[model samples]
Target chain A: AQSVTQPDIHITVSEGASLELRCNYSYGATPYLFWYVQSPGQGLQLLLKYFSGDTLVQGIKGFEAEFKRSQSSFNLRKPSVHWSDAAEYFCAVGPLMDSSYKLIFGSGTRLLVRP
Target chain B: DAGVTQSPTHLIKTRGQQVTLRCSPKSGHDTVSWYQQALGQGPQFIFQYYEEEERQRGNFPDRFSGHQFPNYSSELNVNALLLGDSALYLCASSLWGQTSLDTQYFGPGTRLTVL
Candidate 1:
């Protein structure tokens, strides 16, 4: 079965510190990967996506993710953590089964920024 | 454009009742997709509509149905709702694409609380 795995349910980082959130996926073919961020009581916003070509994709709000095909991983990264950046992050994979546009998402990781 | 828009930000329904949620696709988007986001989990795809037809669907039961109008707006109807049906319902819009690589923009989502 195709699915996404976010091992960390929650992570905390101090303001101004670097942060990384791990994501792994299981799929048969080359998967379309995406990262989304959701603030409390808000809708999800697309952070970035990896379809083909470049493995390192830069997103809004100074966020970026590197897709490593060998490990089936697409980890999101930020050079400096900000208080406003604390939110829930979701990793999703789009499998090309029957040309369906459905997205299989991970359980999600909640980020907490400390002062 | 105005981006995707969903109506009735919050709703309450009882078991065995029926409910309908509406969505308006972003300004130039031609496809609309529905998703169910349970507490503490990522969103799960329900279905997608394009050109007033059901294009693709996820693993949802028949109890969940949808309709798209000529104007490219859509509605999702759930029959015989269960307590487990209580979740955040999200609506996303995208341009018609042959693959899942198309970028989907999301709405604020409707919070459904079933009793």
Candidate 2:
């Protein structure tokens, strides 16, 4: 079975500080990894995804993730955090061969940016 | 192009009642997948529909069913809903038939509450 783990349940950082959300996945083979963000009472927004090729994938909203297959990790990072960037973050894994993939997600990490 | 959209943004139902949520995939997307997101948790895969047929399913019970129309829109039907079934149901759209990989665009999601 495939699964994702986001060890951080909650993280608070000052505005303009660096941010990193760790994610680790368990899959038998190479898996499709993704990061998604959700604001309060809003639908989820895709931050970044890694299918293949580049280990470093850049996404919208000034976010980027590095996929380290050997470590079985795909951690999301941002150079500087903004107050509006506070939200819930999720890491997901899916099948590599299938286009209509079923996503397995982690428990999620809540980010709180402070002034 | 318009992004994926879900109807009945919020729904309230009693235990043992039945509810149906609808989703319209993004333009040019042929596959629709459903997910259940509990409060304070990440989303879990429910199933995926492509070409009006279910291509993949998660560990959900048979009480959860769905249908995809010829126009590529979809619906999620939950019968004999329990209080535990209360969650935000998300609909994601992706292009099928690709052996390699693709991104699944998500909708705003429908919030269901069971009393």
Candidate 3:
């Protein structure tokens, strides 16, 4: 079974500071990884995904993630944090074969940006 | 383009009651998947519908059922709801493909509360 693990339950970052949220995944084969952000009372928005090529993937909102196959990790990062960037972040893994892909998500990491 | 839409933004129902949540997929999307997000937790996959048929399902029990319409809209029905069932029901749409790299667009979830 595929699973995702986000070790950080909560992270507090000062405004303008670099931010990194770690994610580790477990899968039998090459996993399709994704990062999603959910604001309070809002739907989740896809941040980025890693399927085949470039291990480094860019997403909206000044976010990017690097997929390290050797480490089985796909960590999300931002050059600088902003107050508006505070939200819950989830890491998910999907298989690479079927169209009915189901995502196995981590418990989530809540980000708090301090001004 | 209008994103995926879910009806009844919030609803309160008593235990043992039945509730139905509706979803309209984004334009050009042919598959709809449902997820349940508990407070302080990540979303859990429920099932997916394609071509008016259930193509995949998660570990949820039979008490949770759904239907897909000819128009590509979908409905999730939960019977004999329990307090544990109170969560944000999210609807996601995607274009089914042979590979699992398909991106799923999510809608603002319907918040359900069981009293």
Q: Candidate 1 at residue A45, lDDT?
A: 97
Tens digits of per-residue lDDT for model 2, A34-108 = 899999888888898888898999999999999998999999999999999999999998764455667899999
Could you give the CAPRI-style class of model 1? medium
Clashing pairs in 2: none
* Each model's DockQ score: 0.60, 0.67, 0.66
Arranged by DockQ with the best first, the candidates are: 2, 3, 1
Determine which window of 10 residues in candidate 3 chain B has minimal summed lDDT.
B95-104
Off by over 4 Å in 1: A96-100, B98-102
Which lDDT tens digits does candidate 1 get at residues A1-115?
A: 9999999999999999999999999999999899999998898899998888999999999999999999999999999999999999999998744444678999999999999
Q: How many clashes (backbone atoms < 3 Å, residues ≥3 apart in a chain or on different chains) does model 2 have? A: 0
**Once superposed on the true structure, which residue ranges of model 3 sit more than 4 Å away at CA?**
A96-98, B98-102
- lDDT per model, in order? 0.93, 0.92, 0.92
Weakest lDDT window of 10 consecutive positions for candidate 2 chain A: A94-103
lDDT of 3 by residue, B17-72 (tens): 99999999999889999999999889999999999999889899999999999999
Query: Residue B95 deviation, candidate 1, in Å?
Result: 0.3
